[model samples]
Target: MDHKKVMIFLLSSMLFISSSGSITAGESSEKIKAKLENIDYGDITLKDSAKVKPSFNLQEVSSNETKQNFYDERIPKVNLESGAVISQKNKQIEIPFTQPLDSTDEALYSHDLVIKQLGLANTPTLIPVMEYTTRVEGNQIIITFLVDYTDEYSVQVKDPYFIRSNGNLATPSDVYITTKNAPVNVDSPKVSLESGTVIPQINKEIEIPFTQPLDSTNEALYAHDLVIKQLGLTNTPTLIPMMDYTTRVEGNKIIVTFLVNYTDVFSVQVKDPHFIRSNGNLASPSEVYITTSNTPVTIESPKVSLESGTRITQSNKEIEIPFKQPLDSTDEALYAHDLVIKQLGLINTPTLIPMVEYTTRVEGNKIIVTFLVDYTDEYAVQVRDALFIRSNGIPAIQSEFYTTTKNDQLIVD
Candidate 1:
């Protein structure tokens, strides 16, 4: 009976030990399953036995999203000691400070902070800052300042400023006043034509227009001082008034017309050589024939011959004849007789007697007639006697020859 009781106690003790082992094994299995489900493969933990708790917040689950939000929030709140605010409201921001940050701020900073926040890489080196009282009106913001700083600052800032650091701020530029002195003692302007330059005859009237208008108050400014220089000419400049000029503008070009008064300085010279001839004495009619070496000439009623060879008549009526022949005594006598008869008709015939003598000679390609006549009737009568001969063998007598006698009238050949 004792042996039976010992068996029952041993069996009960073995059953209890078996149940405790199963319970411990089941608890370990549950803990292992929970750790396996919660463990982050991305994170490295030094303690293998340590348990990892599951994060309940949806945002905490995404490491990338958490980092992005942190950066976005941190960038906008950045402020500089220079009173510059780096915020999302101002699309453009400029920073001027250049210094290392102290340990008081534990935030992570980067040079690309503005770039990353704004999603813009190429920002202006220096950006102007404007601050004024702003009022919200509907969808727009109306900003006003009692004493605006931007205008004053712009006057002071001559060149663009370069940004040196992030979150740095600068005061607005200062106001400046610049004064310049007016030009002094400006002489009147002048227009000059180039030397040896020939302008079109039709374009004698020219008007020159200025790129910029002259002062209306100063009349001298409107006056044009012009100088014209030509080849083989004196260097005297001509002056004219600009107000009298006319102008027209075609695109960017100016057409100027000047009322120019031009004068020719050189005088033309004319010359000719001529000869006067008679039969014997200067009292008789003479003939004149002109020879010109240069320009052509016109004679006004040029009396080639005259009964009184002492004088020649040149009047309003003119006659033109080219120089071709050598004038001599015979030609002179014939010309004089013909002129008297033709002009005064046969009724006005004054017994014509040659009073001049001409000695004709030929020199090279030219013919010359020398005058040798004096105003004397005796010399004319002597010439007439020498030229005339008795008709039909009758002895020629001066008185009977010229007078009408008996039944015979005086005749001359």
Candidate 2:
């Protein structure tokens, strides 16, 4: 063999030994020899021998992950004081723990811890808590959000799997906080009646406006006090009573319809704080007095006669007269005195009819008349000359009325 060949073989052997030695040294550097305690919310202090690695990256970790999935597993859960958490944009939040967190390894727990403000019913608010850095500081972890705080808050940890240096995983849990400093009347509900609406008309509507939108599903409208009374009458204070009136909400206004019996000078009283707003707030109480006159509504009185194109015949003893409009049947007194038979045509000589028994009724838009009289020839009947009032209290003009006659056999021989 040649000297050059021997030298080349020696160089190759040395290179192999150096490469193998370096590979063995790399393994020792990567091996961990440090110990760690439980991971908690706090600052971290790294030691030369720290070995526990976090499951996620701290820089890219978000505090929002713990909002919905946080669970506490302790036998007796720990919580912050009631209403102790105040919302602040740049303020530091100090969360104290029962025990100290392991700072020997910063990577044992995730940095995705977050603080959130709890709303009504312990639900989270919509405002986002800005990203924050975590460190094991004594027995507490300090947090800071990017936005100002408007409510109480709680703490949550994402990737709560707390791994210790001994390869043991800690139970996952969350911390809740409350605040005592809050606005006294941040969400109070308010309402007011429409202006220039002190007097509501009979069967007319009035509206009440609210400062905020009301709860559409709330049944507060059903709980109301409706009373009506004449200003100077000696009658008892009457409750308009349920079912007499109606109330409903349209948008932010409450519509109230009055169902009154009379137009006498009366006062309508409604109790205040009668409803609840959508924000779980109560509606303030209010009273409104409605003043109206004793004026009665009037309608036209109908003329009495046979139906149009109808004629009185021997077999047609019934007289049906239609009115110009639909009559208000609610007025019983008007129907009783509005009609009277004055004259009866007997033997074709129109003679005064006295002491005649008759029956009067209403059907649809017409008043029906019937009488017991003997007819021996073509005849006619006349209504009395008087002003008859309609069912709605409107008086009909004084006019003479005559029934139509058709030459035929007598209605009753």
Backbone Cα, N, C clashes tallied per candidate: 18, 22
Worst 10 contiguous positions by lDDT, candidate 1: 273-282
For model 1, how does the per-residue alpha-carbon lDDT over 152-241 read when each residue is reduced to its tens digit?
111122221221123332222322211112232122222122322222323434333222333222122212222222111222233333
lDDT (tens digit, per residue) of candidate 2 on 186-291: 3545555453234434445545566766555433343353355543223325544445556667777666665665543344554544234434344555564444
Question: What does the lDDT read for residue 253 in candidate 1?
Answer: 21
TM-scores of all candidate predictions against the true structure: 0.14, 0.25
lDDT of each: 0.25, 0.43
Off by over 4 Å in 1: 1-199, 206-233, 241-246, 251-253, 264-413
